[model samples]
Target: MADKPTVTIIGLGSMGQALASAYLEAGHRTTVWNRTPAKADDLVARGATRAATVSDAVWASDLVVLCVLDYAAVDELLAPNADVLKDRVVVNLTNGRPDQARRTGEWATAQGAEYLDGGIMAIPSMIGTPEAFILYSGSRTAFERYEAALRVLAEPKFVGTDAGLAALNDLALLSGMYGTLAGARHATALVGPERAAEFTTSLLIPWLQAMANILAPSSAEREAGDREAGDLPSEESPLDMQAAGLANIIEASRSAGVGVDLLTHLLTPMRDIIAAGEGDVLTDLVEVIGKEIRS
Candidate 1:
């Protein structure tokens, strides 16, 4: 059998440690470094090498994985070792804006390294698990070459050759996740503390799961291509109906002394759609949002 590729992890934060552990457990020769130094002790004891400096770490492996504090820290660490980065594949999994990812990708390329900007969709504990998936964008060739070793960390999704795509999708998914959480919090508040647990466990979870299944297809269709602005499906729940329902929910929440801020975001767009006298479907709100975003 071919030997597993060597890996050098250049951060020792929770996610970085998890990445190093995954590679080490998969029988790869792993080298780890962190600014604190002591963070590499555990991995070093598990048959991994402890790099004395960032240069040593970069020079130790063909695949260099970075999960640092931010893009600025990434620059601070890699700049000094720029010469050692040549011919290596740098997988940056730092959290940052799309622009930052693209700029870092350019910097890595200028140093003669192949780059892959990564957006890890999992928490530290989920690394190497079936449920975890990390998005990758940039250098299709590099991704294809190191795909196997990368899989040791999580399921890798190659989004595109554009370095910014991974970060874009990452932030977009996070926005959706946070929006859902906000709605969940508002829902729980509406039900009062005594019933919150039961409501979430029994009603909210099942209802959300079912609604997600129904809504996903429509979302997918919209994303597949550019549709006419008014091309909304003739769904059962029209815009006026949804707007009225939302208005009532707001009123009820207000009367019950529960905050309606989260619910009002949806209501605002629905009201605009009704006032515009456009298509009547609830999905028509998508067009309203699209126009505002484009503007």
Candidate 2:
């Protein structure tokens, strides 16, 4: 019924521009900035004001939306102008680490500013959709203060006040995505690209999505340990099949003159599963996979 809010968005890359577009569409006065300057031209054409510099961008609004490369970039760019950012609610939608988040949160607080570390769960095109799972962690007060501006990007998923949970969760989800990708790469090679697309689009996508949904809850399930005490869904995928599948890729790559190092590295350890005779259970091969690579 009225003007939504005045927001400043820095780093006008694909994701950052998408954020600017969403805010503009939602009736917020959005001031945008980018290193190249030309990157913000399109956003400028969309009724968004392009700030002269990062300092001006920060000075333009009560909320600063940072959707940049990573947390390191945030520090490198904002450190000099930290004084201008004092007391502004900074909603960092950049990909980063939990430790980095805590460090950044402390730095922002020291400068008399508020910070919220956010993890984006959607692609650039899905910016304003409800399925875009946006994660925010940090000061609850800061998050509440700028919740509306955050919503201009995605379906805001508030992870808690821990200041690191969002990054941790973000990393976990990314690991799963990469894992699924690894499997697909191998499968495409095994089945041949011609047939790969058909199998992948029709079967792989749905199958992996279902597994991912199941695995989301199963992560907690395995932690609680009431579901018969074991590893991942071994009975379904099977360790022997998976092991053979991995081996087949390694062999095929050699024959096809392609590098299969990643495959070997990922699947080589599973030889123990086959040796242990639990090759029928896909879950048993994962006694060594740790939290470090899940995302």
Q: Largest TM-score belongs to which candidate?
A: 1
CA shift at 122, candidate 2, in angstroms? 1.1
Residue 38 C-alpha lDDT in model 2:
98
Candidate 2 local Cα displacement, residue 86, angstroms: 2.1
- What candidate 2 gets wrong by more than 4 Å, as runs, is 1-3, 213-225, 228-249, 252-259, 273-281, 291-295
Compute the lDDT for candidate 2: 0.81
Over 1-295, each residue of candidate 2 has an lDDT whose tens digit, in order, gives 1456689999989899888988889888889999889999988998999899899999999888888898778988789998897879888888989999888888888898888889999998998997887999998998786677687788888898888899999998998788878877866776677898898999888987776665443655667763544235446787767878778768888887766866776575577556766446666555435411453
Candidate 1 residue-wise lDDT, 94-144, digit = tens: 998999999999999999999999999999999999999999999999999
Q: Give the TM-score of candidate 1.
A: 0.89
Clashes of each: 0, 4
Clashing pairs in 2: 174-295, 175-295, 234-282, 240-279
